[model samples]
Target: MGKIFTVLLVIVGFVYAKPEIVIEDPWVRAVPPTAKNTALFMVIKNVGDDPDTLIGVKTDISKMVSIHKTVNQNGVMKMVHVDKLTIPPNSKVELKPGGFHIMIMGLKRGLKIGENVKFTLIFEKSGRIILEAPVKMK
Candidate 1:
């Protein structure tokens, strides 16, 4: 009985272990059906000891999702594509408006208010993270 109890304790610890990466306040902007592009915002925290690379993202709402960063060139603001975003260990990355964000292009359907968009955040080390991002104005 003691051996069985020990095994159970180990199992529970593994099951309840915290994830190396965490996401906070994930959301997608509500857009009209006619709108061609939209974006997703979130705060990603890496609490692990090793770095991870955010390689890609997937969503059924658009034809493709890619990482983008807003940059000011001369006096004009522009959005540029990012091949990959690295999240250093014990660091936080914010994907917010007028900054680094995820671009969802060629949306198949309009996003309704209060609805949720299925998002899959792919990482090089930590693997896939699937979550539902709520649609909101801000």
Candidate 2:
């Protein structure tokens, strides 16, 4: 009976397990009026034991929002679309310039500095996280 009880406890714990995600320093890049695209940068930290994957992003500022990564191909830098970005348990992933970032394309208007933009980040395990990121330069 003791063994069975222990197994039940383990099962219960597994059922309740979830990823604790924290977003820090989230900001959108300021763009000119003629610019049609921009990017969002932030630090994604997972404090829980379970890992989570960032699968998609939704924003009203643009119709096209997707994950992208900067890569060097034959000594030339380029940005490539990525389907997902995984954040490991107890670790943090920094989305900065020249690295992983969220590409906001088809901008409806220029993103001015100090303007806040709402974004819904979809995670595989953590679900949708809504945040307002301020627009900044660099």
Candidate 3:
């Protein structure tokens, strides 16, 4: 009876434990009211044993959502589309200014400071993760 009870307790605990996901330093830079584009930055840390792929992003404020990476072509900054961003097992992937970012293009409305932009980020392994990026004056 004792062994059966212990086994049952262990199984229950394992079943209820979900993967640990950590999002760090999430922020959106406020753009000029007349500008058509802006960006978001954050670091996603996956503490699970398996890898995850960030496949898609959704936000209502932008007419289009895309994953972009910056590159220097002859000292000129250029943005390119990414097929997918990977978060390795027990690792963190950073989306920082002048690096990888979420490009919000064709802005439907102006983003003001102290406001939040909700984003749904879809992952291949761990499913979907939602992020709330606060707009701040840069």
Candidate 4:
């Protein structure tokens, strides 16, 4: 009887787990003191059963923020601004350097190492995610 009760408790806990999208490895690269642009990288995972779109990004430390993707066309590497990035259900999307990343332009000030930068990621279905990315020099 005790074993059955323990199993029931475990099942109940799993059923009541939080259901939402997850953000993984959210960090920012500390830019040079004279640099004017920097990027943030992260992996977004949709743990829920529904798809979600990252519609907008807002930050106080930059003059402009946008989703950007780098592509090689005709042997020329170009960076283009993307409007929205979608995260499929039960899948993960990685935003890393040299690929899809969050571009921050016109930095108000240079990012110092170990500083926390706050960002608000607006999603279409999962709502706004408030997160802070630690600045690293990697």
Candidate 5:
């Protein structure tokens, strides 16, 4: 009876020891066909007790997909590449314009409004999350 109880406790603990990540309101900026770059915005929510880190992003529409943050450098606004983005336990992170965003560079084609683009978000704890973001002119 003692061994069975111990095993059950361990199993329960393992089940709860993970990050629950949710992506919400994912969208990409709609740009003209001549445009070569665009951005993606979304809200990332971590509802679990464990924290998670967004390490990478993948998409076929662009040659490079990366995490970036807009910053004011010497009174000039610039987008800087970020290595990773962390979402704390039970908290949320917003990726919006002039803030933390996913930069899609060297686009093969322009993003049309009302169209969806598939993206694979790689997280440290939660692994890869596949989702589609619609193109909008927000």
Candidate 6:
């Protein structure tokens, strides 16, 4: 009977777990101090059964925040602004340096390396997810 109870508890814990949306290997590359634009990269994992969409992003370090994707158009790299990014159920979405990234424009000040930058990511079904991604010279 005790063994059965333990199994049940484990299953319940996994099922009710607040969807794991980890910002894996989050880092910001080194840029000129006078640079007006910078990008952030990370991988978001969704362990829940329901899908979640990153509708918007908010940060205090920059005046403009937008979801952007870099695509190859006629052998030329082009960056396009997007409204929302989607993450399927039990799947992972990668936002790398040269791929889908968060564009932060009009910096209030140069982001110092080792300083933590907080961002609130609004999702469709998961509500809001907050992440503290540190600035790294990567």
Residue 32, model 2: lDDT of 83
Off by over 4 Å in 2: 1-6
Question: For every model shown, what is its TM-score relative to the native structure?
Answer: 0.84, 0.91, 0.83, 0.84, 0.88, 0.82
- Using lDDT as the measure, which candidate wins? 5
Q: How would you encode candidate 4's per-residue C-alpha lDDT over 1-138 as one tens digit per residue?
A: 999999999888666643368998899989889999999999999997667899999999999999999888998999998999988878899998889999999999988899899999999877899999999988
Select the stronger candidate by lDDT from 1 and 6: 1
List, residue by residue over 65-115, the lDDT tens digit for candidate 5.
Answer: 999999988899998989999999899999999999999999998778999
Candidate 6 structure quality by residue, lDDT tens digits, 1-138: 999999999899767755556558777655789998998889988887666788988899889899999998999999998899888778999998778999988889988888888888888777787888888887
Query: Which residue pairs show backbone clashes in model 6?
Result: none
Once superposed on the true structure, which residue ranges of model 1 sit more than 4 Å away at CA?
A: 1-19
Arranged by TM-score with the best first, the candidates are 2, 5, 1, 4, 3, 6
Model 3 Cα lDDT, one tens digit per residue, 1-138: 999999999888667644456789899989889999999889988887566788989899999989999988999999999979988778898998889999989999999998999998888866788889999886
Instruction: Name the runs in model 4 displaced over 4 angstroms.
Output: 1-19
Regions of model 3 farther than 4 Å from truth: 1-20
* Model 4: lDDT of residue 120: 97
10 residues in a row with least lDDT, candidate 5: 11-20
The local lDDT score (0 to 100) that residue 48 gets in candidate 3 is 76
Better of 4 and 5 by TM-score: 5
Q: What is the Cα-based lDDT of residue 52 in candidate 4?
A: 82
Worst lDDT 10-window in candidate 2: 10-19
